[model samples]
Target: MLSLRGVRKSYGGTPALRPVDLDLVAGELVVLTGPSGSGKSTLLMIAGGWETPDGGEIVPRPPLPEVPVDRMSWRDLGFVPQSISLFEELTLADNLALARGGPGGAELLEALELGHLAARRPGEVSRGEQQRAAVARALVAAPSLVIADEPTSHQDHRRARLVLDLLRAAAVRGAAVLIASHDAAVVSRADREIRLDAPAVAPG
Candidate 1:
Protein backbone atom coordinates (compact mmCIF):
# COMPACT_ATOMS: atom_id res chain seq x y z
CA MET A 1 0.00 0.00 0.00
CA LEU A 2 2.97 2.31 0.37
CA SER A 3 6.48 2.63 -1.10
CA LEU A 4 9.43 4.88 -0.41
CA ARG A 5 12.57 5.20 -2.48
CA GLY A 6 15.80 6.92 -1.46
CA VAL A 7 13.85 8.92 1.09
CA ARG A 8 15.98 11.39 3.04
CA LYS A 9 15.20 13.88 5.75
CA SER A 10 17.07 16.39 7.94
CA TYR A 11 16.21 19.01 10.49
CA GLY A 12 18.28 22.07 11.43
CA GLY A 13 21.51 20.38 10.37
CA THR A 14 20.60 17.18 12.15
CA PRO A 15 20.11 14.07 10.04
CA ALA A 16 17.02 11.99 10.65
CA LEU A 17 16.64 9.51 7.81
CA ARG A 18 19.21 9.07 5.08
CA PRO A 19 18.35 7.50 1.76
CA VAL A 20 15.85 4.94 2.95
CA ASP A 21 13.71 2.63 0.84
CA LEU A 22 10.66 0.76 2.13
CA ASP A 23 7.54 -0.96 0.85
CA LEU A 24 4.33 -1.83 2.69
CA VAL A 25 1.63 -4.09 1.29
CA ALA A 26 -1.74 -5.43 2.33
CA GLY A 27 -2.13 -8.45 4.65
CA GLU A 28 1.22 -7.78 6.26
CA LEU A 29 2.50 -6.05 9.37
CA VAL A 30 5.89 -4.34 9.05
CA VAL A 31 7.90 -2.95 11.92
CA LEU A 32 10.68 -0.38 11.74
CA THR A 33 13.44 -1.06 14.25
CA GLY A 34 16.48 1.00 15.22
CA PRO A 35 18.13 2.82 18.06
CA SER A 36 17.31 6.34 19.13
CA GLY A 37 18.28 8.97 16.52
CA SER A 38 18.08 6.27 13.84
CA GLY A 39 15.02 8.00 12.33
CA LYS A 40 12.42 5.35 12.90
CA SER A 41 9.86 7.96 13.88
CA THR A 42 10.91 10.25 11.02
CA LEU A 43 10.31 7.46 8.57
CA LEU A 44 6.88 6.81 10.03
CA MET A 45 6.06 10.53 9.80
CA ILE A 46 7.06 10.69 6.14
CA ALA A 47 5.19 7.50 5.36
CA GLY A 48 2.07 8.83 7.01
CA GLY A 49 2.29 12.15 5.09
CA TRP A 50 2.53 13.99 8.40
CA GLU A 51 6.08 15.22 7.69
CA THR A 52 7.36 16.07 4.23
CA PRO A 53 10.64 14.43 3.32
CA ASP A 54 13.49 16.60 2.06
CA GLY A 55 14.03 14.25 -0.89
CA GLY A 56 12.85 10.99 -2.48
CA GLU A 57 9.34 9.75 -3.12
CA ILE A 58 6.45 8.04 -1.34
CA VAL A 59 4.11 6.04 -3.55
CA PRO A 60 0.81 4.42 -2.74
CA ARG A 61 -0.60 1.33 -4.41
CA PRO A 62 -4.11 0.62 -5.70
CA PRO A 63 -6.95 1.00 -3.19
CA LEU A 64 -4.79 3.60 -1.47
CA PRO A 65 -6.27 6.20 -3.84
CA GLU A 66 -4.32 8.33 -6.34
CA VAL A 67 -4.68 11.56 -4.43
CA PRO A 68 -1.95 13.04 -2.23
CA VAL A 69 -1.39 11.02 0.93
CA ASP A 70 -1.97 14.06 3.07
CA ARG A 71 -5.31 14.68 1.41
CA MET A 72 -6.59 11.21 2.19
CA SER A 73 -9.30 11.13 4.82
CA TRP A 74 -8.70 9.71 8.31
CA ARG A 75 -10.73 6.62 7.40
CA ASP A 76 -8.23 5.85 4.63
CA LEU A 77 -5.08 6.51 6.66
CA GLY A 78 -4.99 5.53 10.30
CA PHE A 79 -1.97 7.12 12.01
CA VAL A 80 -1.10 6.82 15.67
CA PRO A 81 1.70 9.27 16.27
CA GLN A 82 4.58 8.75 18.71
CA SER A 83 3.25 11.36 21.03
CA ILE A 84 -0.22 10.60 22.30
CA SER A 85 -2.70 13.25 21.11
CA LEU A 86 -5.98 12.06 22.51
CA PHE A 87 -8.45 14.85 23.26
CA GLU A 88 -8.59 15.57 26.98
CA GLU A 89 -11.90 17.34 26.62
CA LEU A 90 -13.67 14.24 25.40
CA THR A 91 -14.20 10.87 27.02
CA LEU A 92 -12.10 7.96 25.76
CA ALA A 93 -14.99 6.52 23.77
CA ASP A 94 -15.84 9.90 22.33
CA ASN A 95 -12.28 10.43 21.18
CA LEU A 96 -12.57 7.27 19.11
CA ALA A 97 -16.07 8.21 17.97
CA LEU A 98 -14.55 11.14 16.10
CA ALA A 99 -12.82 8.78 13.67
CA ARG A 100 -15.52 6.11 13.64
CA GLY A 101 -19.19 7.07 13.61
CA GLY A 102 -20.69 4.34 15.77
CA PRO A 103 -20.23 1.22 17.92
CA GLY A 104 -16.81 0.44 16.51
CA GLY A 105 -15.27 2.83 19.00
CA ALA A 106 -16.91 0.94 21.83
CA GLU A 107 -15.79 -2.40 20.47
CA LEU A 108 -12.19 -1.21 20.23
CA LEU A 109 -12.28 0.19 23.74
CA GLU A 110 -13.52 -3.14 25.01
CA ALA A 111 -10.90 -5.09 23.14
CA LEU A 112 -8.18 -2.88 24.54
CA GLU A 113 -9.63 -3.49 28.00
CA LEU A 114 -10.64 0.13 28.35
CA GLY A 115 -14.42 -0.45 28.22
CA HIS A 116 -15.11 0.23 31.87
CA LEU A 117 -13.19 3.46 31.64
CA ALA A 118 -14.90 4.60 28.43
CA ALA A 119 -16.42 7.53 30.24
CA ARG A 120 -13.07 8.79 31.50
CA ARG A 121 -11.17 11.55 29.79
CA PRO A 122 -7.56 11.07 28.70
CA GLY A 123 -6.25 13.03 31.66
CA GLU A 124 -8.16 10.86 34.04
CA VAL A 125 -6.50 7.65 32.88
CA SER A 126 -3.01 6.25 33.24
CA ARG A 127 -0.51 7.02 30.49
CA GLY A 128 -0.71 3.42 29.34
CA GLU A 129 -4.46 3.61 29.14
CA GLN A 130 -4.25 6.77 27.08
CA GLN A 131 -1.72 5.14 24.78
CA ARG A 132 -3.95 2.11 24.25
CA ALA A 133 -6.86 4.43 23.65
CA ALA A 134 -4.90 6.17 20.92
CA VAL A 135 -4.18 2.81 19.32
CA ALA A 136 -7.86 1.90 19.59
CA ARG A 137 -8.94 5.14 17.94
CA ALA A 138 -6.64 4.50 15.00
CA LEU A 139 -7.93 0.98 14.51
CA VAL A 140 -11.59 1.86 14.99
CA ALA A 141 -11.84 3.26 11.48
CA ALA A 142 -10.26 0.16 9.92
CA PRO A 143 -8.30 2.23 7.42
CA SER A 144 -6.67 0.74 4.34
CA LEU A 145 -3.24 1.57 5.80
CA VAL A 146 -2.11 2.01 9.38
CA ILE A 147 1.03 3.83 10.53
CA ALA A 148 1.93 3.75 14.18
CA ASP A 149 4.99 5.17 15.92
CA GLU A 150 6.09 3.45 19.14
CA PRO A 151 2.57 2.19 19.66
CA THR A 152 3.44 -0.06 22.56
CA SER A 153 5.85 2.30 24.31
CA HIS A 154 3.54 2.65 27.28
CA GLN A 155 2.43 -0.92 27.76
CA ASP A 156 3.62 -3.89 29.76
CA HIS A 157 4.11 -7.35 28.22
CA ARG A 158 0.52 -8.53 28.18
CA ARG A 159 -0.89 -5.20 27.07
CA ALA A 160 1.78 -4.87 24.42
CA ARG A 161 0.88 -8.32 23.14
CA LEU A 162 -2.76 -7.32 22.97
CA VAL A 163 -1.93 -4.28 20.87
CA LEU A 164 0.28 -6.35 18.58
CA ASP A 165 -2.46 -8.93 18.06
CA LEU A 166 -4.93 -6.23 17.07
CA LEU A 167 -2.45 -4.80 14.58
CA ARG A 168 -1.80 -8.26 13.20
CA ALA A 169 -5.53 -8.74 12.86
CA ALA A 170 -5.75 -5.51 10.87
CA ALA A 171 -3.12 -6.82 8.48
CA VAL A 172 -4.90 -10.16 8.23
CA ARG A 173 -7.99 -8.27 7.12
CA GLY A 174 -5.95 -6.87 4.19
CA ALA A 175 -4.81 -3.52 5.54
CA ALA A 176 -1.12 -2.69 5.34
CA VAL A 177 0.17 -1.98 8.84
CA LEU A 178 3.44 -0.09 9.33
CA ILE A 179 4.76 0.49 12.79
CA ALA A 180 7.92 2.09 14.24
CA SER A 181 8.84 0.19 17.38
CA HIS A 182 11.96 -0.91 19.23
CA ASP A 183 10.17 -3.25 21.61
CA ALA A 184 11.22 -6.83 20.95
CA ALA A 185 7.70 -8.11 21.51
CA VAL A 186 6.40 -5.76 18.86
CA VAL A 187 9.15 -6.58 16.37
CA SER A 188 8.96 -10.33 16.89
CA ARG A 189 5.27 -10.35 16.02
CA ALA A 190 5.52 -8.43 12.74
CA ASP A 191 5.41 -10.15 9.37
CA ARG A 192 8.55 -8.23 8.33
CA GLU A 193 11.09 -5.88 9.78
CA ILE A 194 12.86 -2.77 8.47
CA ARG A 195 16.07 -1.61 10.11
CA LEU A 196 17.25 2.02 9.83
CA ASP A 197 20.46 3.83 10.75
CA ALA A 198 21.43 7.21 12.08
CA PRO A 199 23.03 9.50 9.58
CA ALA A 200 26.72 10.20 10.05
CA VAL A 201 27.65 13.67 11.19
CA ALA A 202 30.45 15.77 9.76
CA PRO A 203 32.94 17.29 12.13
CA GLY A 204 31.79 20.74 13.31
Candidate 2:
Protein backbone atom coordinates (compact mmCIF):
# COMPACT_ATOMS: atom_id res chain seq x y z
CA MET A 1 0.00 0.00 0.00
CA LEU A 2 2.20 2.84 -1.28
CA SER A 3 2.29 5.51 -3.92
CA LEU A 4 5.19 7.16 -5.75
CA ARG A 5 4.97 10.39 -7.69
CA GLY A 6 7.33 12.13 -10.08
CA VAL A 7 10.23 9.91 -9.06
CA ARG A 8 13.47 10.53 -10.88
CA LYS A 9 17.04 9.15 -10.74
CA SER A 10 20.36 9.42 -12.58
CA TYR A 11 23.94 8.22 -12.34
CA GLY A 12 26.96 10.35 -13.26
CA GLY A 13 24.63 12.89 -14.95
CA THR A 14 23.00 10.23 -17.12
CA PRO A 15 19.38 9.59 -16.32
CA ALA A 16 18.56 6.10 -15.09
CA LEU A 17 14.89 6.79 -14.51
CA ARG A 18 12.48 9.29 -15.90
CA PRO A 19 9.95 10.93 -13.62
CA VAL A 20 7.63 8.03 -12.77
CA ASP A 21 4.44 7.58 -10.85
CA LEU A 22 2.93 4.36 -9.49
CA ASP A 23 0.44 2.98 -7.02
CA LEU A 24 1.05 -0.28 -5.14
CA VAL A 25 -2.00 -1.76 -3.52
CA ALA A 26 -2.49 -4.67 -1.17
CA GLY A 27 -3.34 -8.15 -2.54
CA GLU A 28 -2.01 -7.45 -6.01
CA LEU A 29 0.75 -9.16 -7.98
CA VAL A 30 2.26 -6.57 -10.33
CA VAL A 31 5.08 -7.22 -12.75
CA LEU A 32 7.44 -4.70 -14.28
CA THR A 33 8.52 -5.79 -17.76
CA GLY A 34 10.82 -3.94 -20.12
CA PRO A 35 13.96 -3.87 -22.24
CA SER A 36 17.44 -4.27 -20.74
CA GLY A 37 18.09 -0.59 -19.87
CA SER A 38 14.50 0.28 -19.15
CA GLY A 39 15.06 1.26 -15.51
CA LYS A 40 12.70 -1.32 -14.01
CA SER A 41 15.27 -2.31 -11.44
CA THR A 42 16.10 1.32 -10.77
CA LEU A 43 12.46 2.10 -10.17
CA LEU A 44 12.12 -0.90 -7.85
CA MET A 45 15.18 0.26 -5.90
CA ILE A 46 13.80 3.76 -5.57
CA ALA A 47 10.28 2.58 -4.75
CA GLY A 48 11.62 0.27 -2.05
CA GLY A 49 13.93 3.00 -0.77
CA TRP A 50 17.00 0.85 -1.48
CA GLU A 51 18.16 3.82 -3.57
CA THR A 52 17.29 7.46 -3.31
CA PRO A 53 15.55 9.36 -6.06
CA ASP A 54 16.79 12.64 -7.42
CA GLY A 55 13.33 14.14 -7.26
CA GLY A 56 9.96 12.63 -6.32
CA GLU A 57 7.89 11.51 -3.36
CA ILE A 58 7.09 8.15 -1.75
CA VAL A 59 4.17 8.08 0.62
CA PRO A 60 3.92 4.70 2.33
CA ARG A 61 0.73 4.08 4.21
CA PRO A 62 1.32 0.64 5.68
CA PRO A 63 -1.90 -0.80 7.05
CA LEU A 64 -0.82 -1.74 10.58
CA PRO A 65 2.02 0.67 11.19
CA GLU A 66 3.46 3.90 9.85
CA VAL A 67 6.84 2.50 8.92
CA PRO A 68 8.46 4.54 6.17
CA VAL A 69 8.60 2.60 2.91
CA ASP A 70 12.31 3.11 2.38
CA ARG A 71 13.18 2.41 6.00
CA MET A 72 11.13 -0.72 6.61
CA SER A 73 12.71 -3.55 8.55
CA TRP A 74 12.75 -7.12 7.23
CA ARG A 75 9.80 -7.81 9.48
CA ASP A 76 7.60 -5.28 7.73
CA LEU A 77 8.96 -5.77 4.23
CA GLY A 78 10.03 -8.86 2.30
CA PHE A 79 12.52 -8.44 -0.54
CA VAL A 80 13.97 -10.95 -3.03
CA PRO A 81 16.78 -9.05 -4.68
CA GLN A 82 18.53 -9.87 -7.98
CA SER A 83 21.68 -10.92 -6.21
CA ILE A 84 21.42 -13.89 -3.88
CA SER A 85 22.68 -12.70 -0.49
CA LEU A 86 22.30 -15.85 1.57
CA PHE A 87 24.99 -16.39 4.18
CA GLU A 88 27.44 -18.88 2.81
CA GLU A 89 28.82 -19.67 6.24
CA LEU A 90 25.53 -20.77 7.71
CA THR A 91 23.41 -23.78 6.91
CA LEU A 92 20.22 -22.96 5.14
CA ALA A 93 18.25 -23.53 8.33
CA ASP A 94 20.54 -21.32 10.34
CA ASN A 95 20.40 -18.67 7.70
CA LEU A 96 16.67 -18.68 8.16
CA ALA A 97 17.10 -18.33 11.88
CA LEU A 98 19.22 -15.28 11.25
CA ALA A 99 16.27 -13.60 9.56
CA ARG A 100 15.65 -11.65 12.78
CA GLY A 101 12.16 -12.54 13.98
CA GLY A 102 10.90 -14.10 10.78
CA PRO A 103 8.72 -17.16 11.19
CA GLY A 104 7.78 -20.16 9.01
CA GLY A 105 11.14 -20.74 7.38
CA ALA A 106 10.80 -24.51 7.43
CA GLU A 107 7.37 -24.50 5.89
CA LEU A 108 8.54 -22.17 3.17
CA LEU A 109 11.44 -24.41 2.36
CA GLU A 110 9.16 -27.43 2.08
CA ALA A 111 6.79 -25.52 -0.14
CA LEU A 112 9.63 -24.72 -2.49
CA GLU A 113 10.80 -28.34 -2.34
CA LEU A 114 13.97 -27.18 -0.64
CA GLY A 115 13.39 -29.07 2.61
CA HIS A 116 15.92 -31.80 1.84
CA LEU A 117 18.67 -29.26 1.42
CA ALA A 118 17.99 -27.39 4.62
CA ALA A 119 21.19 -28.51 6.25
CA ARG A 120 23.42 -27.45 3.40
CA ARG A 121 25.27 -24.18 3.03
CA PRO A 122 24.75 -21.73 0.20
CA GLY A 123 27.83 -22.95 -1.64
CA GLU A 124 26.75 -26.54 -1.13
CA VAL A 125 23.50 -26.20 -3.00
CA SER A 126 22.68 -25.43 -6.61
CA ARG A 127 22.19 -21.79 -7.51
CA GLY A 128 18.52 -22.36 -8.18
CA GLU A 129 18.06 -23.95 -4.79
CA GLN A 130 19.89 -21.06 -3.22
CA GLN A 131 17.61 -18.63 -5.00
CA ARG A 132 14.53 -20.46 -3.74
CA ALA A 133 15.96 -20.38 -0.26
CA ALA A 134 16.42 -16.66 -0.60
CA VAL A 135 12.77 -16.39 -1.57
CA ALA A 136 11.80 -18.47 1.44
CA ARG A 137 13.77 -16.21 3.72
CA ALA A 138 12.04 -13.15 2.31
CA LEU A 139 8.59 -14.63 2.90
CA VAL A 140 9.28 -16.10 6.34
CA ALA A 141 8.36 -12.82 7.98
CA ALA A 142 5.00 -12.37 6.26
CA PRO A 143 5.96 -8.85 5.27
CA SER A 144 3.36 -6.36 4.12
CA LEU A 145 5.23 -5.43 0.97
CA VAL A 146 7.25 -7.89 -1.13
CA ILE A 147 9.58 -6.57 -3.81
CA ALA A 148 11.49 -8.98 -6.02
CA ASP A 149 13.88 -8.43 -8.92
CA GLU A 150 13.85 -11.23 -11.46
CA PRO A 151 13.07 -13.77 -8.78
CA THR A 152 12.50 -16.64 -11.15
CA SER A 153 15.52 -16.13 -13.37
CA HIS A 154 17.29 -19.16 -11.99
CA GLN A 155 14.59 -21.81 -12.26
CA ASP A 156 13.05 -24.14 -14.81
CA HIS A 157 9.35 -24.30 -15.57
CA ARG A 158 8.29 -26.33 -12.54
CA ARG A 159 10.48 -24.58 -9.99
CA ALA A 160 9.56 -21.22 -11.41
CA ARG A 161 5.93 -22.15 -11.03
CA LEU A 162 6.55 -23.06 -7.41
CA VAL A 163 8.16 -19.69 -6.83
CA LEU A 164 5.35 -17.87 -8.59
CA ASP A 165 2.72 -19.74 -6.64
CA LEU A 166 4.45 -18.84 -3.41
CA LEU A 167 4.61 -15.19 -4.35
CA ARG A 168 0.99 -15.19 -5.47
CA ALA A 169 0.03 -16.81 -2.20
CA ALA A 170 1.68 -13.90 -0.43
CA ALA A 171 -0.44 -11.50 -2.39
CA VAL A 172 -3.56 -13.48 -1.58
CA ARG A 173 -2.71 -13.13 2.07
CA GLY A 174 -2.64 -9.34 1.64
CA ALA A 175 0.83 -8.23 0.65
CA ALA A 176 1.75 -5.96 -2.21
CA VAL A 177 4.15 -7.96 -4.39
CA LEU A 178 6.00 -6.06 -7.12
CA ILE A 179 8.38 -7.92 -9.38
CA ALA A 180 10.65 -6.77 -12.23
CA SER A 181 11.25 -9.28 -14.98
CA HIS A 182 11.70 -9.87 -18.71
CA ASP A 183 10.16 -13.35 -18.77
CA ALA A 184 6.98 -13.64 -20.76
CA ALA A 185 5.74 -16.49 -18.58
CA VAL A 186 6.19 -14.36 -15.51
CA VAL A 187 4.39 -11.47 -17.17
CA SER A 188 1.45 -13.66 -18.20
CA ARG A 189 0.78 -14.67 -14.60
CA ALA A 190 0.79 -11.17 -13.19
CA ASP A 191 -2.45 -9.43 -12.23
CA ARG A 192 -1.09 -6.33 -13.95
CA GLU A 193 1.96 -5.37 -15.94
CA ILE A 194 3.97 -2.13 -16.05
CA ARG A 195 6.10 -2.12 -19.17
CA LEU A 196 9.13 0.15 -19.32
CA ASP A 197 11.52 1.41 -22.00
CA ALA A 198 15.10 2.63 -22.19
CA PRO A 199 15.65 5.88 -20.35
CA ALA A 200 17.05 8.81 -22.28
CA VAL A 201 20.74 9.57 -21.94
CA ALA A 202 21.71 12.91 -20.50
CA PRO A 203 23.42 15.55 -22.66
CA GLY A 204 27.16 15.94 -22.22
Candidate 3:
Protein backbone atom coordinates (compact mmCIF):
# COMPACT_ATOMS: atom_id res chain seq x y z
CA MET A 1 0.00 0.00 0.00
CA LEU A 2 3.04 2.22 0.23
CA SER A 3 6.15 2.40 -1.93
CA LEU A 4 9.43 4.23 -1.49
CA ARG A 5 12.19 4.45 -4.09
CA GLY A 6 15.68 5.81 -3.48
CA VAL A 7 14.56 7.79 -0.44
CA ARG A 8 17.21 9.89 1.33
CA LYS A 9 17.35 12.42 4.12
CA SER A 10 19.98 14.41 5.99
CA TYR A 11 20.13 16.52 9.11
CA GLY A 12 22.76 19.27 8.96
CA GLY A 13 25.85 17.66 7.40
CA THR A 14 25.02 14.11 8.47
CA PRO A 15 22.55 11.87 6.76
CA ALA A 16 19.70 10.23 8.64
CA LEU A 17 18.38 7.99 5.88
CA ARG A 18 20.07 6.40 2.93
CA PRO A 19 18.68 5.73 -0.50
CA VAL A 20 16.27 3.20 0.94
CA ASP A 21 13.72 1.45 -1.20
CA LEU A 22 10.70 -0.11 0.50
CA ASP A 23 7.26 -1.40 -0.30
CA LEU A 24 4.45 -2.37 2.10
CA VAL A 25 1.65 -4.28 0.50
CA ALA A 26 -1.89 -4.39 1.74
CA GLY A 27 -2.60 -7.10 4.35
CA GLU A 28 1.06 -7.45 5.23
CA LEU A 29 2.85 -6.51 8.41
CA VAL A 30 6.38 -5.31 7.65
CA VAL A 31 8.98 -4.94 10.35
CA LEU A 32 11.80 -2.42 10.01
CA THR A 33 14.73 -3.70 12.03
CA GLY A 34 17.79 -1.60 12.84
CA PRO A 35 19.84 -0.32 15.72
CA SER A 36 19.35 3.05 17.31
CA GLY A 37 20.29 5.86 14.91
CA SER A 38 20.07 3.52 11.95
CA GLY A 39 17.29 5.73 10.56
CA LYS A 40 14.46 3.41 11.48
CA SER A 41 12.39 6.17 12.99
CA THR A 42 13.30 8.55 10.20
CA LEU A 43 12.14 6.01 7.67
CA LEU A 44 8.88 5.56 9.55
CA MET A 45 8.29 9.30 9.66
CA ILE A 46 8.95 9.57 5.96
CA ALA A 47 6.70 6.66 5.14
CA GLY A 48 3.97 8.07 7.37
CA GLY A 49 4.31 11.49 5.71
CA TRP A 50 5.44 13.14 8.96
CA GLU A 51 8.90 14.04 7.66
CA THR A 52 9.92 15.07 4.18
CA PRO A 53 12.63 13.11 2.46
CA ASP A 54 15.43 15.06 0.82
CA GLY A 55 15.30 12.87 -2.27
CA GLY A 56 13.25 10.13 -3.95
CA GLU A 57 9.54 9.50 -4.31
CA ILE A 58 6.85 7.86 -2.15
CA VAL A 59 3.60 6.37 -3.34
CA PRO A 60 0.96 6.43 -0.65
CA ARG A 61 -1.92 3.99 -0.18
CA PRO A 62 -5.27 4.29 -1.85
CA PRO A 63 -6.82 7.79 -1.88
CA LEU A 64 -3.29 9.15 -2.17
CA PRO A 65 -0.91 9.34 -5.07
CA GLU A 66 2.74 9.38 -5.93
CA VAL A 67 3.94 12.79 -4.81
CA PRO A 68 6.94 14.82 -3.79
CA VAL A 69 8.10 14.05 -0.25
CA ASP A 70 6.86 17.37 1.15
CA ARG A 71 3.34 17.13 -0.16
CA MET A 72 2.22 14.05 1.69
CA SER A 73 -0.35 14.21 4.52
CA TRP A 74 1.24 11.40 6.57
CA ARG A 75 -1.39 12.18 9.21
CA ASP A 76 -3.88 10.21 7.17
CA LEU A 77 -1.64 7.30 7.98
CA GLY A 78 -2.05 6.10 11.59
CA PHE A 79 1.12 6.54 13.63
CA VAL A 80 2.17 5.48 17.11
CA PRO A 81 5.54 6.81 18.07
CA GLN A 82 7.73 5.47 20.90
CA SER A 83 6.28 7.89 23.35
CA ILE A 84 2.60 7.29 23.92
CA SER A 85 1.21 10.78 23.43
CA LEU A 86 -1.77 10.24 25.70
CA PHE A 87 -3.00 13.13 27.74
CA GLU A 88 -2.26 13.41 31.41
CA GLU A 89 -5.62 14.95 32.27
CA LEU A 90 -7.89 13.19 29.86
CA THR A 91 -9.29 9.76 30.49
CA LEU A 92 -7.89 7.16 28.12
CA ALA A 93 -11.27 6.56 26.55
CA ASP A 94 -11.89 10.24 26.10
CA ASN A 95 -8.53 10.70 24.47
CA LEU A 96 -9.34 7.96 22.00
CA ALA A 97 -12.75 9.42 21.39
CA LEU A 98 -11.13 12.73 20.56
CA ALA A 99 -8.85 11.00 18.12
CA ARG A 100 -11.78 9.39 16.30
CA GLY A 101 -14.05 12.39 16.41
CA GLY A 102 -16.21 10.42 18.88
CA PRO A 103 -16.69 7.02 17.34
CA GLY A 104 -15.56 3.48 18.25
CA GLY A 105 -13.81 4.42 21.44
CA ALA A 106 -15.45 1.70 23.48
CA GLU A 107 -14.88 -0.94 20.85
CA LEU A 108 -11.21 -0.12 20.46
CA LEU A 109 -10.78 0.05 24.21
CA GLU A 110 -12.36 -3.36 24.58
CA ALA A 111 -10.37 -4.81 21.75
CA LEU A 112 -7.14 -3.71 23.39
CA GLU A 113 -8.38 -5.10 26.71
CA LEU A 114 -8.49 -1.56 27.99
CA GLY A 115 -12.19 -1.23 28.57
CA HIS A 116 -11.80 -1.33 32.33
CA LEU A 117 -9.29 1.49 32.38
CA ALA A 118 -11.30 3.86 30.26
CA ALA A 119 -11.63 6.35 33.11
CA ARG A 120 -7.95 6.45 34.01
CA ARG A 121 -5.53 9.10 32.89
CA PRO A 122 -2.27 8.06 31.32
CA GLY A 123 -0.31 8.63 34.49
CA GLU A 124 -2.53 6.24 36.41
CA VAL A 125 -1.97 3.31 34.10
CA SER A 126 0.85 0.83 33.71
CA ARG A 127 3.30 1.36 30.89
CA GLY A 128 1.88 -1.47 28.82
CA GLU A 129 -1.65 -0.28 29.31
CA GLN A 130 -0.70 3.17 28.16
CA GLN A 131 0.95 1.75 25.10
CA ARG A 132 -2.15 -0.24 24.26
CA ALA A 133 -4.16 2.90 24.72
CA ALA A 134 -1.95 4.57 22.19
CA VAL A 135 -2.61 1.76 19.79
CA ALA A 136 -6.32 2.08 20.43
CA ARG A 137 -6.15 5.78 19.70
CA ALA A 138 -4.50 5.10 16.37
CA LEU A 139 -6.91 2.34 15.44
CA VAL A 140 -9.90 4.32 16.50
CA ALA A 141 -9.34 6.37 13.41
CA ALA A 142 -9.26 3.20 11.32
CA PRO A 143 -6.85 4.61 8.78
CA SER A 144 -5.89 2.55 5.78
CA LEU A 145 -2.30 2.19 7.00
CA VAL A 146 -0.54 2.00 10.39
CA ILE A 147 3.06 3.06 10.97
CA ALA A 148 4.46 2.37 14.41
CA ASP A 149 7.94 3.39 15.60
CA GLU A 150 9.45 1.50 18.53
CA PRO A 151 6.04 0.30 19.58
CA THR A 152 7.22 -2.32 22.02
CA SER A 153 9.31 -0.06 24.18
CA HIS A 154 9.10 -0.28 28.01
CA GLN A 155 6.70 -3.16 28.19
CA ASP A 156 6.89 -6.74 29.46
CA HIS A 157 6.86 -9.63 27.02
CA ARG A 158 3.18 -10.46 27.36
CA ARG A 159 2.10 -6.89 26.94
CA ALA A 160 4.43 -6.33 24.06
CA ARG A 161 3.03 -9.38 22.38
CA LEU A 162 -0.46 -8.16 23.02
CA VAL A 163 0.25 -4.83 21.39
CA LEU A 164 1.90 -6.42 18.39
CA ASP A 165 -0.96 -8.87 18.13
CA LEU A 166 -3.38 -5.98 18.07
CA LEU A 167 -1.37 -4.48 15.25
CA ARG A 168 -1.34 -7.77 13.41
CA ALA A 169 -5.08 -7.97 13.68
CA ALA A 170 -5.22 -4.59 12.03
CA ALA A 171 -3.05 -5.88 9.21
CA VAL A 172 -5.31 -8.90 8.90
CA ARG A 173 -8.20 -6.56 8.44
CA GLY A 174 -6.28 -5.05 5.47
CA ALA A 175 -4.50 -2.06 6.98
CA ALA A 176 -0.86 -2.02 6.01
CA VAL A 177 1.12 -2.33 9.26
CA LEU A 178 4.72 -1.10 9.37
CA ILE A 179 6.57 -1.28 12.64
CA ALA A 180 10.11 0.07 13.07
CA SER A 181 12.00 -1.36 15.97
CA HIS A 182 15.05 -3.23 17.26
CA ASP A 183 12.90 -5.64 19.24
CA ALA A 184 13.55 -9.22 18.22
CA ALA A 185 10.16 -10.42 19.39
CA VAL A 186 8.40 -7.99 17.11
CA VAL A 187 10.68 -8.76 14.17
CA SER A 188 10.15 -12.46 14.47
CA ARG A 189 6.40 -12.01 14.58
CA ALA A 190 6.33 -9.74 11.52
CA ASP A 191 5.09 -11.03 8.19
CA ARG A 192 8.22 -9.58 6.54
CA GLU A 193 11.34 -7.79 7.66
CA ILE A 194 13.44 -4.95 6.26
CA ARG A 195 16.90 -4.28 7.62
CA LEU A 196 17.97 -0.64 7.35
CA ASP A 197 21.42 0.93 7.53
CA ALA A 198 22.52 4.26 8.86
CA PRO A 199 21.40 7.12 6.69
CA ALA A 200 23.68 7.43 3.70
CA VAL A 201 22.82 9.98 1.08
CA ALA A 202 23.66 9.15 -2.49
CA PRO A 203 26.25 11.20 -4.36
CA GLY A 204 24.59 14.17 -6.04
Pairs that clash in candidate 1: none
- Candidate no. 2 TM-score: 0.91
Q: For residue 41, what is the lDDT in candidate 2?
A: 90
Whole-model lDDT values for every prediction:
0.82, 0.82, 0.79
Could you estimate the TM-score for every candidate? 0.90, 0.91, 0.86
lDDT, residue 171, candidate 3 = 89
Candidate 2 lDDT tens digits, 110-190: 999999999999899999998898888878878888888899999999999999999999999999999999888889889
Candidate 1 differs from the real structure by a C-alpha RMSD in angstroms, to one decimal, of: 3.4
lDDT of 3 by residue, 1-204 (tens): 789998988899688887899998888999998767779989887887667889998885234324433222233567687877776788998877766766467977877778999999999999888888888877777777898878888777887887888899888889999998888999888999999875465468
Off by over 4 Å in 1: 61-73
Q: What stretches of model 3 exceed 4 Å from their correct place?
A: 61-75, 198-204
| RMSD vs true structure, all candidates | 3.4, 3.5, 4.3
- Per-residue lDDT over 21-59 for candidate 1, one digit per residue giving the tens place of the 0 to 100 score: 998889999999887888888887778776788899888
Off by over 4 Å in 2: 61-73, 100-103
Ranking by TM-score: 2, 1, 3
